[model samples]
Target chain A: MSTAQRRLDIEEVGDVTVARFIDKKILDETNIQIIGNQMFGLVDEDGRKRIVLDFTNVEYLSSAALGKLITMDKKVKAAKGKLRLCCIRPEIYEVFEITRLNKIFDIKKTQEEALEGF
Target chain B: MRAGLVEVGSLVPFQLKRWDPQPCGEPRRPAEPEKSPLEFAQEMTDREQFEIFIPSETAAGQAVQDRIIQRLEARGFTDRDVFGIRLSLEEALVNAIKHGNGMDPSKSVRVCCQIDTETVVVEIEDEGDGFQPEEVPDPTAEENLERPCGRGIMLMRAFMTRVEYSDHGKCVTLEKRRSVEGE
Candidate 1:
C-alpha cells in the first residue's frame, strides 16, 4: 500500500523501519484492517527485517487492532526478524499490561532506544 | 414492537421495546422527554442519555460509538476515562456485531448509554444466540498471552468499574465512575 493510503508514517532509522501510526484512535475496524495489511506488507512483501512501531500518535486502540499487532509480531518472528514498540502513551501501555502483551513484545521508551541494538 | 425497555442504569438484562426502525436504518435516538426550561437548563450538562439501535455492521456501529464518546467529552470525562470507555465500547460493540450477531444484516444491536456527573453507564445487547462468557480462555495465561482474540473481555474488565453480562451473555453492561483529581 502507498504511504498515503497506509495509516502509518514510515521512516527508516539506520536498518530499522520505524512505522508510526497516523490515527489517534485505532478503533474503527476498516482502518484497523487497512493498517494491519500495510504493516504486514512491510515484512511479507517488502522483506524489511528490523521493525519498530511508534505509537506516539495513537490515543485509543481496540482489541482488534491489538490482534493485528500480534499477527505482525508472529510474522516478524517467522521471518527471523525483530520487532520493537515505542512511544506508547501510559494509557495504551496499561492496555498492553492488562492483556499481558507487555511480556510478549519488546517495548522501549523512545524511538532512539528502539532503534538501538537492531 | 416489543414494549420492554432496556434501562441503561440497570445491571439486569432487559429486552428492548421495539420501535419503528429509523429511516435508512440509521441509529435511532430516543426522543427527549418534556422538561421545563429551568429543569432543562439545570440538567443540561449534568446528564446525557441516548438509546440507539444499529444494524450489525462495524461501520454502522461507529456512529453510535462516536456519539457516546462525544457525550463523555461534553460532560467533562477525564481523558483516561474516555480512553477506556472508548476502548471498551469498541470491543463490546464488535463482540455484538461480529460474534453475537455474526454480522447478519437482519440482526441489530442496541446500545443504551447514560452519562452523568459521577458515572457513565452503557448497555449493549444483540439479537442472536448468546454464548457463555466462561467458555472464553484466559488470554493472560502464559500459553495464551500471544493470542489476540480473547483479550477484549479482559481489557473491558480492567478498564471499567463494573462489567456484567446477562441474558446468556447477549447483553453486556459497562459502568465507570468518573476519576477524581487525586484518587
Candidate 2:
C-alpha cells in the first residue's frame, strides 16, 4: 500500500520512532491490517531500536488492534528493540488494564515520558 | 427476562430465547404476563430493535456496527457507553465473521440489536461449528499475555454487562446497561 493509505504518521526523534495513529477509531480490519504491516515494518524493515506509539488522537481501539500491538511488541523484542505506548485515553487504558496487558507493555502517560531514558 | 415483552425485530425465533445465565445459573426465560400482544408492543415503543444479516465479511460487520453506533447516539447513550459498546461490537462481530464463520464467504452472520433508554442488547449468530467459551485460554494469564489472539472474547466480557452464548456457541448475546451521566 502507498503512503496515502498509511494509517500511522511516523516521526523520528533521535534513535526512537514515534508513530502517531491517524485514525480516531482503530476498529476496521483492513485499516488494522495496514497498521500492523506498517508497525511491523518499523522494526522488521527500518530496523529501528526504540519506538513510541502515541495514541493521543485515538478515541476507540478494538481487540483486533490490540492483537497487532502485541505482535509489534514481540517483533521489537525479537529485534532487540524497545516499544512503549503513551497518551492512551482513559477508556482505552481501561481496556489494557482489563486484559492485564498493562503489566506486559511499557505504558507512559505522555509521549515525552515514553521517549525518555531510551 | 423482562416480562411480556416479545422481542420486536428478532429475525430468527432462536434470537428471542434469552441465553443469559441468571444468578442461580439457570437460563432465564421471559415470563408471560396477562397483558395482550398489543399492550406488550405498546410497552416496547420506547425501544428500538432491528436485525441485520450479512455475509461473513468484516466490511459487512463494520457497517452493522456503524448502524448500531448511530442508534446508540440517537438514544442518548453517553460517550463512555458508546465506547464500550463499540469496542464490544467490534470484538463480537469480528469473532463471528473471522472465527465463527472462519471467513468463509458462503457463510453468513446475523446481527440483532435492541436499544432503549437504559439498556442495549445485541446478538450475533454465525454459521459454523461452535466452540466452548471455557476452552478459550485466558488471555491475561502469565503464559498467554504476549499471545496475539484470544483477547476478543475477554474484551467483550469486560465491556458488556453480560455476555452469553447459545446454539452451541455459534450465537453470542452482548448486553450493556447504560450508566447514568452523574454516576
Candidate 3:
C-alpha cells in the first residue's frame, strides 16, 4: 500500500498528482488507518485523486503489497482519478511481467516523466 | 476443496531420475517412510518451522522449479499442467521471500515438493518472524486504496486449489489436484 513512510511531497501539475514514498513496507499496519481516509476525506480541492507512486528505496514487493495497489487503483478509478506507478526496480518489474500486470498499471520509465505526463 | 486440494497441473513421468535400483541386495528399503530434508514445515512466517535450506535468490528458485518441471514432464504432464505447477512453485518461493524471510537475500528459504500417485505437494519456508493471516490487507476491499500487497495469496489460491499456511505463517504448503485422464 502507499506507506505513510514518506509521501515525501505531493503536488499536481495540470491534472497530474505526484507523491514519493520512502522506506515504507515496514512502517507497520499504522498506514492502513491513514490510507483508509484518503479514499474520501483526502480528496483534493479539484476533486480528482490522481496519484503517481515513486518507489526509489523500496526493493522487494510481495503479492500483498501489489494487492493494495489494486485496491487503491479501484478507488481512484471510481472517483475518476488515475493511479500510476513510477520508479520501480527491475526485479519488481519481473513480478508484474509474470502476472501480466504490466498491462494493468500505468508503469512509467521515470518518475519525472510520469508526473509530467499526467 | 477436497479434490482441488491436491491438483496436479502436468503429468510428465520421471525419465531422468537416476535408474540405479539393481544394487545393494534388492535395495534395502527403509522400514519407515523416507523422510524429506525437513520433517515439519512452518505454518506461517510468524510461527514458521525449519525445513530444507536453499539460497534465497531468483536463480536458486528457478533451478528448483526446473527440476520439478523436468520430473513432471517425464511423468507425462501436459504443457498447461506444467505451467500451473510453475505458477504454484513461483508463488511458494515468493511467499517465502516476502513473508518468511522478509525479502532478505542474506537469508535462505527452504522448499520441499513431495509428489505421490494421487497428489503433488509443494512447501516453502522462509526466515522471518512470520505474519498472521489477519494482517493481510484485503485488495478487493475499498479501504485499501492505492496500496500494493496481498495479491500473492489471491493468485496462489486461484492457481492452486488448496494452500495452507504453517510455521505460524513462515511456510506455505500448496497442493493441486491431478487429472485422471492420462496423457
Candidate 1: residue B122 Cα off by (Å): 0.8
The segments of candidate 3 whose C-alpha lies over 4 angstroms from its true place after superposition are A1-118, B1-52, B180-183
Tens-place lDDT digits, model 3, residues A27-107? 222343344344333344346687787776665444545555566667778888777788887756766665556766899
User: Relative to the unseen true structure, what is the C-alpha lDDT of residue A59 in candidate 1, on a scale of 0 to 100?
Assistant: 89
Tens-digit lDDT track for model 3 on B86-168? 75676677667645676577899877666544456677778888878667776455554335555667666765757877667
Number of the predicted model whose TM-score against the real structure is largest: 2
Per-model CA lDDT versus the true structure: 0.85, 0.86, 0.59
For residues B1-183, write the lDDT of model 2, one tens digit per residue.
344343443422543464232333566766668878676566566766777789998899889999999988988888988899999999999989988999999999988887767798898999989989999999999999988888988988888899988888999989999998977
CA displacement after TM-score superposition, residue B165 of candidate 2 (Å)? 0.5
Error of 2 at A56 (Å): 0.9
Residues A1-118 of candidate 1 have per-residue lDDT tens digits of: 5654768889988788999999988887788989999999999999998999999999888999989999999999999999999999999999999998999999999999998888
Residue pairs with clashing backbones, model 1: B2-B18
* Candidate 2, A42-104: lDDT as tens digits: 888889879999999999998888999999998989988899999999999999999999998
Candidate number 1, chain A TM-score: 0.95
**Against the true structure, what is each candidate's TM-score?**
0.84, 0.87, 0.45
Please tell me which predicted candidate would have the highest DockQ against the true structure: 2
TM-score of chain B of each: 0.75, 0.80, 0.63
